[model samples]
Structure formats: C-alpha cells, structure tokens
Target: DEPGLRVKLAEGPQKFYIGVDPTGPSLHIGHLVPIYASAHLQKAGHQPIILMGGGTARIGDPSGKTELRQMISYAQIDKNIASQKPQISKLIDFDNTNALLANNADWLAPLNYIDFLRDIGRHFSVNRMLTFEAYKQRLEKGLSFIEFNYQLLQSYDFLELYRREGCILQIGGDDQWGNIVAGMELIRRVESAETYGLTFPLVTRSDGKKMGKTEKGALFLDSSLTSVYDFYQYWRNVPDADVERFFLTFTFLSVEECRALGAAEGSDINKSKERLAYEVTALLHGEKEAVKAREGAKAAFSGGGDKSGIPSEKIGKAELEAGINILDLFSRTSLCSSKSEARRLVLQGGARVNDVKIEDAEALIGMADAVDGELMLKAGKKRFFRIELTD
Candidate 1:
C-alpha cells in the first residue's frame, strides 16, 4: 500500500512541498523518486511546491556524509539554479493552477542572526538533535558547527513555507526522514500547524549499487554532459531485476500496469526495458528527441545499415586528405578508451569503417571512404560515429 498520504492529501485544499538542494547543476535518476511523487500528487489534484534550497545549499547538508561538502560559491549556486529550471520544467507543469517554484534564499538571506537564534533556534534541542542519524554519524567522523546547524535551517525553511504558502506536506527520500521529521516538529512547535512528512524509498540497482552513476561519473540530465542516445541506452540496459522498479519509481505508469510489465519478464523483458527507456527519455528530453535517441541507439548497436542514425562530428578536409588512421580516429572521438584499445579492437575484427571491417591496425582511412562527404565508423557492437570532412 502507498499509505494514506495520498488519501489524506485528497481531503482538503492542502499544499505539498518538496525541497531539492542545488548541490549540483542538474538532477539525475536519483532525484526522480521525489520528482515523480510530487508530480503524482499534482495529478491527484493537490498543490505542489518545489523549494529550491539556494540558501541551505550554501550551508551544505551533511546527511549520509562523513565530511562536509565543499561550499559552492554564491555565483556558482546562482548558475546551478538557472540551469536546473529547464530540466525541472520538463517534468511538471509549473504553469498549472497548483504548482509553485520557490527559492529559500528569499527569506534565509535576509534573516538577522540574533533573531534566528532567539526565535527559530529556540525550538531545537541539542540533546534531541545529536540523536539524529546524520548528526550521530557525523559526530563519530568529526562534525562541524556549520553542518550541525543544517537541520535547523532546513526545519526553518519548512516552517516558513507552511506560513507563507499554506503548505502542509513535505516529501523527501528515506535518508532525509530525520531532517524531515525535524521540520514537521518545528512547524508544530513554532506555528502550531500540523504538517506531514513523507519519505520515499531511495532507488538502488539490483546489484545494491546506487543509480544515476557510471564508471565515468554522475549521469547528468543536461544533454551537454550526457547525450540523449547514451541516456536512453542507460535505461535500456538496466538489469532485468531492476527494470520494473525503474518504471514504477521513474514513470507515471500505475502500479498495476507496471506489474503487468514485470510479469512478462522472462519472455519479453527487452520490450519492457525499451518502453521504460523511451517513456523516461521522452519525459526528460521530449518525444521527438526520445525517438531520435532510440533510433540512434539502434543504428549504433545494430551494425552498419543506413548511416542516418550515426552521431556526427566535423573534421577538416586536410586531415581526411592526409589519411587518418582508424585507431587514432576512434581514440580521438572517445569511442574507445585508448589508441591501444582501438588497435586491439581492429585486430579482433571488432572495428569497422564505412560498414567494412578493418583488419589492419595501421590502415589509413581517406576521403574515398566518405559517403556523401561523411565517414561512419563502428566500434564493437554498440558504438557509432560519423566524421564530416570540411575544407
């Protein structure tokens, strides 16, 4: 059962609030749990407020950490906030009658230190605070005063939202339950308001590893950081054990529908994963982009056919005329890890140029290989690139 939070959510003109710290410039798969839940609440006819933790981000939350995160400069924080707006806008309709976007710095930046300590800080207890999981863990690892005060500032943000926006519910991941409960308690003590806190399960891979990360680094929502084709493939290649959960946690598909997809696992799991990838990619990057990304993946993984789906990169005519080695080209485009790896791939019959296998490691590719002025290169079973020769 999803608990009665959704039921209770239906009983009144209630406003729901969820906070996301601008610790990074983009949201990843890790953020989808809360974002999808908030979007669900909105679809169910409740108001949803997304609080951008511009102020608290400066202080840095120490939850699930042994050391304080490096403080981001004010300029950097501002830039991050600006970058996140478009990505968030794609998920929920902010123009809807019941949605809001707020920045905590609006209030936190102007507060008097004495007043904050005398009023807001009065409701918090050191004895109770130290018992929190985040604080207790940090204490063992040497917690700082600035990190210690994080919960207080976060709790104050909740209370302020309740007062100003009439918000009554706060949503976050399970790791944030301690901080969330503190916020609910603060609202009860200071404003005498009955606010609710709901924590969703954190998403993890079947291998018990966290999602949204690869050997390279975090999978950013920004296309510049991760190409749409790569993003689609990330979801498509999800372990069968984790695919259904990804659909449920990341998509608007109902539980019953998700279950139906899960039940077909052994025989048709690939289809389900494809649907998951397409739907999720469409939500983030739009249907057209998702379609193109899917096509690009097929072309890259399916071997040389029509070169239309290959991702293109521009090169100089002089370079092509001079005849570039296939191994060097693969390495330069990041299609493979190193020149040695590229040569190894060619030697193993895993490398191809313009749909033809390259057996010679030192074979120089020239303009003759360029069809319609572009040369398509294939590395192994899942990588494709197009080089455009330009004068």
Candidate 2:
C-alpha cells in the first residue's frame, strides 16, 4: 500500500474494488489472492466491488502479455463472467448489500466514440503511457492500438466506480500496479478525490515455478477444466519451502499457525501439506469434495482409505479380455493425452499398471491385470488413474 492508504483506510469503512477481465471461462488459482483479500476486507466492514471487465475484455489486458490476446466473442465473455461468479462467491459474499458485482460493459458499450475521446482520451499522454512497464514490454513485440487503450478504459472504470459507487481503492496482482496507479491518477485528476491501489505479489514456488501451474496447465477453479482431485493434489504436493507462505497467502489461518505448520520437518511436513491441501480445497470446492480428494490421494498413494476419489474411467470387461497395449491403455485415461505421450512415459520407466512398472510400451494388458474389477494405473510417482471394468 502507498503511504496515504493506511491513513485512508483508518478514516472509516471505504469501498475497494478489484477488476477481472473475463478472458477465460474459468478462474484459475492465480485469481484467488485478490478475491481472498477482498473477502478479508469485506469481513472487516469495508465494501467490495468486483468489477467484471466485460467491455475492456474485448480490448484485452496487454499487461503481462507478450503478444496480442486472441479476441473472444461477447457471448463467450458473458459466459466467462457467469462461470467466474460462483467461484468468486466461494469467498466473496454476493448476498451482502455492501458487495457489488459491476460490469464495465454497462457504461462502456453505450459510449459515443468522439465524446469519450474528448472527455477521457485527452487526459492520457502517449509518451507517459508508453513508459509504463506494460506498454514498454509490449512495444518490443508490437503493441496494438486496442491494447494501448486498456489503461485508459481501466482508469475510466475507477473514475466511474468512484462517482457511482464511492469506491476509492483498487486491488490486483503486482503486474497491475501501473494500471492501478494510472486509475488513481485519473481519479485524482478527474474527481479531485484521493483513491488508493493495492497489489498482491505474483506467487511462485520455492523452485521458481509459478504457483498453481501444473504440467497439465493452470489449476483452474472449475473442476471440469482441472479436476477437484488434481487441484487437491497440486497443493498436496507443494514444495515444503512454499507451505508457510502459501498458507498465509491462500488460507485464513493465523500467522502463528502457518509458521508452526510450515516449520514441520521431514515426514511431519507431509501432514502439513495435506492439511494445507484440505484447507485450500475446502475453500474452493466444498469440504466434502476436499475430503474425498484427500482420501482418493491417500488411497492411490498408500492403498488405504477411500478409492472413490481417484479419477476413473470405465471400459468394457470384454475389451480388457481381448487385451490392449500398455501405451494404448495409458492413452485412454487422463494419465496420458495421446499414445505418443504414453510411449514416452512408458519408455522413460514412468508407466505402471496394478502397482507394477511397465517396462514395455507394447506390453499387453488383459483381464489378468484387473484387481477387484479395476486397474490402478500410475504415471511417474504422483499421477494415478483407475480404469474400471464394466459388463
């Protein structure tokens, strides 16, 4: 926070906002920090405005992008907004009168181009705009005129929200700092009002990999996009060095508890990781799903506890009786996306069926491989899949 923000916050309950563009249909784990921050603030008696960038999403945010973002249809953007609300609502209470869900399209879609240029466009200086890190980086890769205008539109969002909703602060990732400051400047210039901006650090693991990123892709909040079990496992497998920071950043646990849990050593750290996974998963999915996922992980890893949580696919009993190649069987489940990938996994000694390492890609899997009408397939040490035999 800027120096004045502390004093401003002390002044009484002030409304703060965070803007999200519906660029994708699902909210990834990357989106959770600010949402959790908003929830924390709202719990402390401040109002929260969750601005849905329906209009600006059309232009797309150029910040943190190396190339022009692919444009999606307005229908898709709207669908994305709808998809995101429930995920956000898991933390932010939409039922509260003080919480607002705003769409920038409501005002921006009806604007007259010339009028906007005369009113809002005249305030931004191109030379200064280019100096912002977002544009400076984009300039090397060719910044589009549409992308260049994003900061201005985003600034207008702050100004408009201030006028209508009395919102005075913006929160987002540190990558959004330039835009957030631009909005603060715009609010100061246009309304002669002092507004604030706060940004959360870009979270990463101790190994320097991005937080919530998996070999599969981003850890999406939508179970269909990233399965609930996989989501649980991602946190469950977080590097020991990351446990404390992630607990403080991602969960509502107290500082002392997070520190103590993060300090766990050797085998004890695994329990801390499991608790972290359960807490985070419960926050996103329901507690029931988190328990199931935990049990599924335990079952898959140790062969004890509920096996129902493991990801499974059904195949005919006749198919297994007829026999399928090891590579082909792996390709059939989420364990592998294609036969070529399965071949690579098998050749690398990462493939297993019924707890036995599969050394040959061409090895045939028959009904003999089934244990209790199911085949437990393992990829590497962590990935597991259950293939169920059906009549």
Candidate 3:
C-alpha cells in the first residue's frame, strides 16, 4: 500500500477515489493540487476514480461563487470531455491500473425528476443543505432550484461510485468539503455504509489571488488554449513567497527536496522556479515540448544581439506588395492591440523594423522594406511578428 494510503486507511483498509469536474475542457494550474494528490494516492496502490462531472457541470456547482454559472449545452460538454482526455492521461497512468474514468452523466442523466426526488433528493435535509457554504452563499444572493440540486447530484455521484467501484473515499479541494461530506452522509443514510472525505488546501498565489490565473488569463493545461511557452512562463514566474507551497501541492517533490529548493533564496530562487516550470510542464505536456517551450522563451527574450535565440514567424509576398501601413500590419499580426497602439509604439521608438527601431508613426512598409521576402516587426523588447511580402 502507498504511504499516504495508510493514513486514509488508518482505521481499516479503504479504497481511495478522487474526482474533478469537467467544468472546463482544460485543467488549469488551480486544479493541480487535487490532481497531484490523486496521482499520489494512485501510486500508493489504491484505486483512483477520475469522475468527469458531465451531469453536474450542466447545473454548475455554486462553490466559491458570487453568482450561479451559465449552463453549458450537452454538445459543448461532450466536446470538452473529448478535449480533456489527453491532458488527464499525461498525469495519471491509465494502463493496467485499477484507475477508472467515469462520467456522472451516466447515472444522473437517466434519472427521472420524480425518481431523483424520491431516491436521492429525499435523503438531503433542506436545513442542513442550506448550511453548506455554496448553498448558503447562493441563497443569500438568491439561488435557483437548478443550482440547489447540484450538491444532491454530486452526492449521488459519490454514492454511486462508492457502491459500484467500492470507492470508500472522496477527495477534492477545501471548497468541496461540504459536498464531500454530503456524499459521505448520503452513503450512510441510504446504504448504511461509512465513507470518508479528504480535501487539500486550495492553491493560491502569494498575493492571495487564485492560482493558475495571471494578468493574461487562466493558465490552461491545454496547449491549444494557452501556448506551451506561456504555460511554462506562468509557473516559472511564481513569487518566491509562494514557491514552496506550490512545490508541495503541485509537484511530487518530497518535503526535504521542497525545503532545499525553498531555502535557495534571492538570485538562486529563479533556478528553483525554472525547475518547477520545467517539471510541471513536462508532467502535463511531454519533456520534449517543455524543452521546446523553454527554447521559445529564451529566443523571445534574448533580443537582436542573438538572432538565433528568437522564435520567428513567416509572412507572405503579396501582402507587402499592397503596401501595408506599419500600424495596420502590426495590429493585424497581433503584435499590438490596435492601430493606435502600434502608432504610439512606433512614435515612442518601441517598434522595430527588422531589428531597427522605427521612429516614424506613418511608416509605410512596402515591398522595398521586405528582407528575404519577409519583414520582421518587433514590438517592445519581446513580441516578434514576421510580415511575409507576398507577390
């Protein structure tokens, strides 16, 4: 049995199970703590059941919310589940293990409204349910009946898993403690079986902001939603104050190893952050992709002094023949937000043409400006765009 498994099974032997909601197609860094915890439990020779809350997602959980979430369509939910499979596979070993992937929709979707009321809904106490943080907040802010049933559905999912898979434990973030306990209670009432709930602390930034989100947006595990380079950079830029907590919750690094990395301090702290980024990225993506992402980051930051260290994009010939306005070109290529921003950048000498600063806001980039059938536009010190002069 796994070391951590002994703790979950302290009183007696119990099967471990964990769950994640497919609220979104990609798992963000915020979801990493529970994911890593589940993976740890799996390695400890306990069963891991990854529950995709397809049914529950339609009636979004009110946990940690100021308002109810917009309901997503079934088609969209299916699409999200399809996209999530690859990312989930990267962390958990799916081969020849007692691991199972289940969708709550399998059971929840088929239940008639009347049957659900009699079979599952009757077990939940209205007064106690209202006491849950998620439900209480919703009621204070005027929650809908649809959202109220979310916990019941989630609890039913837990009961079903407990009966079908012999899953004796459910784990999630601190926010899900009420829901987890609700499931445990339901199992006791309905089947006279005792179940357990364990939750990890919610991962957050040093500044008290939620993890996996930056000024840009949520740092998604899916490379398509967020580029691998940006994903790696997000982890690499964790504040020194939060690095140790991140390592403890996000990586499989032992307590001693995490302590050593945390104690590095000052300039040496970046090395630990880099290793964190690389390992975290490699765990989600592959090592090769992480290496490429790091290379891409180095190339973008190394400046013109080292052209080989920069990531390059290509443009076409006819576009240059049409005489593209430098501002318009920059905006079209996503180098700047708008033509005005591009013009301001040019006037401020922040815009560069083929590594040469362009001081003229009205600069006309024609075929004459094309170098090797391409015009490399640099916005600020980091962003690069290649304008291909077609025909």
The candidate maximizing TM-score is 2
Residues 1-391 of candidate 3: C-alpha lDDT, one tens digit per residue: 2355456566554566666667788888777777787787777666678888888988898888889788789998888888887778887788988678888899888889998899888888889988878777777888888888878888998899988888888888999999999998999999998777888886767887778886447788876667676677778788899888777777788999987887788889988988888888888888987887676566555532323223344556665666777787777755566788788888888888778777877777877776666677787765565554444
lDDT (C-alpha, whole model) for all candidates:
0.83, 0.91, 0.77
Tens-digit lDDT track for model 2 on 1-391?
5679888877889999999879999999988899999999998889999999999998999999999999999999999999999999999998936799999999999989899999888888998898889899989979988898899999999999999999989999998989998998888888888888899988888998998898778899999888888999999999999999989988999999999999999999999999999999999999999999999998998878898898888999999999999988998787888999999999999998988999897799999889999999999999999998999
Model 2 scores a TM of 0.97
TM-scores for all candidates? Answer: 0.86, 0.97, 0.85
What tens-digit string does per-residue lDDT give for candidate 1 at 36-136? Answer: 88888788788889899999999999988888799889989989989998888887788837689999999999999999999989898999998888889
> Model 2 Cα displacement at 63 (Å)?
0.5
Off by over 4 Å in 2: none
Ranking by lDDT: 2, 1, 3
User: Lowest-lDDT window of 10 residues in candidate 1?
Assistant: 302-311
lDDT of 3: 0.77
Clashing pairs for model 1 are none
Candidate 3, residue 210: the lDDT equals: 74
| Residue-level error in angstroms, candidate 1, position 118 | 1.0
Question: How many backbone clashes can be found in candidate 1?
Answer: 0
